[model samples]
Target: MHIGIVGAGLIGVATARELSRRGHRVILVDPEPLSGATHAAAGMLAPVAEVTYDQDDLYPLMATSARMYPDFLAGIEADAAYRTTETLVIAADAADREFLATLAEFQRRMDMECEVITTRAARALEPNLGTAIAGAVRIPGDHQVDPRRLGSALLAQVLQSGGEVRRTRVKAIEEENGPILRLAEGEDLRVDHVLVANGLNAAELVDLPIRAVHGDVIRMMMPAHRDHLITSTVRAMVQGRPVYLVPRADGSLVLGATSREDDLTGVSAEGVFQLLRDAHRILPSVWECEITELTARARPASGDDVPIIDRVADHISVAAGFSRHGILLAPIGAQLAADVVLGEGGNGPLAQSVRLGRFNHSPLEHSTRK
Candidate 1:
């Protein structure tokens, strides 16, 4: 099969690699690959810390993808620089403590490996923790990865595996006899299958209910003397706002993020202030770190905040709306997209949870090729 992937972010790259490895000819189309949400993401694989009480169905998919990370990275030829570090979920005050305690209890009931510990124990694990913390929970299975490195690796592997990557934007997609991709350069390329993995842009090709959820992230480099001040990922609730600090391999830290619905402008002062303020409350030394980069990107999200993986047409499959879990869900999402393209039924619970039919109707019916 000659598959045309419309985006080169984490999901598109992953899908391209998966399809290429399976002996399919893949052409990834993107004007700026990896410059989208994947670039700004912290790449934390913490399904436990990310789980919300209302979204229990997403947990299984996230956990499955997190568990598949080691094998996934090993299979790739390039070094993605994966890191398996436990995450410490901390609370800044009494109210936050009670909220986390309840969350920990809920995770425990779900048979997740979560331990509620005192602030002293949390401080013992991360000595740089501020004294104002109320409590913490240790989710040992959560981990982290460098999404930038992963994207580079996937792109390299796809190219090495005889796949083509076109550095061009897709103007439109029309299906006359087969799927014909109209490029921004005024060219049309026909393919056997098309995967609309273009994040929020997928909605432009197909009438899927994908919206952009914006988030602001900051990258900071720790001082040479205090390089390893915090070794593990720290997630905290500071004054009812959620923030996290993920320490990278090169003595840098990623502090983020502020989740908003419809603000697509550049980075805002309030978002940066909130991130820095909450991060400092968790680790005071963060205030002394040098700010390297401040980025704002929108994650593709559905109305229900779950992924959309379904074959809307015979040769067209849509895989978008990963929301904030794009990095974590890449492996499984790629597999599911490939399965859909190959006409293999992806009937798993995770696949069913994100199937397009759940939206009550699909726009593909109106857009199908005659």
Candidate 2:
């Protein structure tokens, strides 16, 4: 089968790679591939640490994708992107500590590995931690990854596997004889199946209850003397807001992510300041790092915050609304989408759990979601 995937973000690229590996001819369509959320993501693959109070349904997908990371990266020969270092989620104040403690209790109740540790114990694990922390929890199963590296590796493998990447936007998808991808440039190409793995832009092609949730991320280089400043990922709750620091393999740190549903598309000043301020509370040595880059991207968020993966049309499948967890969920999202387009009859991909039909989706060719 020949498959056309729209929107070459991390999800689209991963889906293309999955389909290509499954012996399907694939054409990737996007104006800019990795420059979207894939480029800006901090790549913390922490399903345990990232859990929240009201997202029970999302845990299964996250855990499944976290488990799939090993084989997923290995298949692309990009195992170097996966980092096995564990995660430490700390609290700054008494209130923050109480919050994390309560959350940790909830986490443990769900059979997740969460150990409440004293600040001293946390510092022992990562000697460079600041003393200002009030409490901490060790999530040994949580880890990190390099999303940019994974994206580049996947894109390279797709190209090497005889998959075609059309460096243009897909104007529309019209079902003439089949799913015909009307390109913004060059001639239209028809494929047996079309998958819309685009981020929020998937809304332009297909109707979904998706909105843009923007986040700002900062990249920095640790000083020569302080290489590997913190060996593990650091997450903290300062006051009531959340912040995290993800260390890369090459002594760089990713301090990020302020979630906002505003119109500011570029990097946010307040967001960067909040991240740096909160990060300093966790690791005071953050000021010693050289600022490298600041990026902001909008994550496609569905109404339920869980991703929507389903066949909207007989020849079209849609996978979007990863929210901010796109980096953690891409592997499963890609596989589930592949399963949908391949006409697989099994229930392996949890398609029933996150399909558009959950919204009682009408036929795509007949109507669009309002």
Candidate 3:
């Protein structure tokens, strides 16, 4: 089977890699691969730490994906950027500690590993943690990866396996006889199935109610003397907001994330200040690092904040709106998406959770097609 996939972000590339390796031809289309959220993501595989309130369906998917990471990375030979570093979620004050304690309780009840440790224990583990920190929680299962390197590796492997990647935009997918992909500059390519996984942009091609939520990420290089200054990813809740510092194996730290649903498109100065300011409350040594990169990108989210996976048309399956869990859910999401595109039977709980019928989505209204 020849598959046409739109959007070359983590999800698209992962699905393309999965299908192509299984002897299916793949043509992935994107104007700028990884220019979306994947380009700016600090890949944190933290199913336990990222569990939010009332999102019951999400934790299962995340946990399943986290377990699948090892085998998946080994399959692609992209383990260089993968790390098993533990995560320490810190709290700045008494109120912050209480908030984390409540969250940890929920995590524990869900059969996930979350150990609440004192501030002293946290400082003993990292040694460089801020002295004034109130408390911390340890999650050994949480890990980190370099998104840029991992994405490049996935794309390279797909190419190595004889998949084709077209650096052009896909205008639309029309099904005259089968699925016809209308490309830029008046070109049309037909395919057996088309999968759309291009973040929020998937809305334009299909009736997915995906909206853009922007986040800013900053990269810094630790001082030469402080190599491996922090081995564990440190996430904290300062002033009721969340910020994280993810350390790479290369002695660099990624400080991020201010969630903004505003119309601002560029990197928010306030967001940067919040990350740096809030991060300092947990790891004061961040002041000594040199600022390297500051980036802002829009992550996709749906009305329910779950991924959309269903065949919206006869030969087109849509998989988008992963929100911040794009990298974390790639392993499982890619395989499910490939099955939907290939017409393979799948009625598992994970599949039912993300079906398009949950949203009551209106099917493709394009009358010119079919």
* Ranking of all predicted structures according to TM-score, beginning with the best and ending with the worst: 3, 1, 2
Model 3 TM-score relative to the real fold:
0.97
The lDDT values for all models are 0.89, 0.88, 0.89
lDDT of 2: 0.88
lDDT by residue for model 3 (12-125), tens: 999999898678999999999978899999999999999989898888889999999998898555698999989999999999999999999999999999899989899899
For candidate 2, give the lDDT of residue 34.
88
Backbone clashes, candidate 1? 0
Q: Worst 10-residue stretch by lDDT in candidate 1?
A: 361-370
What does the lDDT read for residue 270 in candidate 3?
96
- In the predicted model 2, the residue pairs found to clash are none
The estimated TM-scores of all candidates read 0.97, 0.96, 0.97
Please write out the lDDT profile of model 2 over residues 244-355, one tens digit for every residue: 9998888899998699999999999999999999999889999899999999999889877889888888788888899889989988888888998898747753667777
How does candidate 1 score on lDDT? 0.89
